[model samples]
Target: MEYGCYVCNKIIKTGEKFTFTKEGPVHMDCFVAAERKKVPEGKAEYLRNLSMILDYELTMLVSLLSLKSEDKETSELIRRRINAIEKQAGETTGLIYNL
Candidate 1:
C-alpha cells in the first residue's frame, strides 16, 4: 500500500524516518515542527490541568508496579498504602494474573 506525509503533503517513501499522530503518518521533522508550533500558547487552562493530572497518575502507576515487582526504593514510601489492595494470585478465587 502507498502512504503520504500528513504535514508535508508529500509521499512517505519506504525506508524514510516517520512518525504517527492521531491525524496520520508524517515525516519526523515535519511532525516535530508541527508539534513545536502548537505549544507555549497551547491547550486551554482546564485541558492543561487535566493533562497534568494524567501525567501524575501515570507516574503513580509506575511506582506501584515497581513495588509489586519488589524493587527497592527510598522515596516511594509515601504511597506505600496502596499495598492494602495488593493480592496474590488466587487470594480471591478466580482473580488470575492481577496487574
Candidate 2:
C-alpha cells in the first residue's frame, strides 16, 4: 500500500505513515521534522504582526518609487521591469501542490 506525505507532498512507499495536525498523511520522517517546527496558536499573533510589518515595508518602498519623476518611456520601462520581477517571484513562491 502507498501513503502520501502531508508536508512535502511526496508519496510514502515503505515507511510508516503519520498524520498531520490538519489530518493529512505524511511519511514518518517528514512528519517528525514538521512537528518539531510547529508553533503554538498563541504565538500566531507574533507571526501575523511580522507579516503586517513586512507588508508595510513593501508598501513604503513602492510609494517611494512612485514619488520619482516618470515620463512615458520611463513608465514603460518601469512597468516591464516590475512585470518581470513579479513573474519570477511568483514562480519561486508558488503556494499550492496536489498529491
Give the per-residue lDDT digits (tens) of candidate 1, residues 1-99: 567988889998654545445577666557545654554554444334433443344344445555543445644553554343222111311111011
Q: Give the C-alpha miss distance for residue 61 in model 2, angstroms.
A: 8.2
List where candidate 2 sits over 4 angstroms from the true fold: 1-68, 95-99
Candidate 1 ranges beyond 4 A from true positions: 41-99
Predicted structure 1, TM vs. truth: 0.39
TM-score of each model, paired residue for residue: 0.39, 0.31
Q: Which RMSD values do the candidates have, in order?
A: 14.9, 14.6
After TM-score superposition, the amount by which residue 60's alpha carbon in candidate 1 deviates from its true location, in angstroms, is 30
Candidate 2: clashing pairs of residues = none
Tens-digit lDDT string for candidate 2 (1-99): 566776787776542323333456554446434443554666455544533443443344354346444498777776776565444423322211100
Which stretch of 10 consecutive residues in model 1 shows the poorest summed lDDT? 90-99
Give the number of the best model, judged by lDDT.
1
What's the C-alpha lDDT at position 79 in model 1? Answer: 50
Look at candidate 1 and give me any clashing residue pairs. Answer: none
Give lDDT for model 1: 0.47
TM-score of structure candidate 2: 0.31
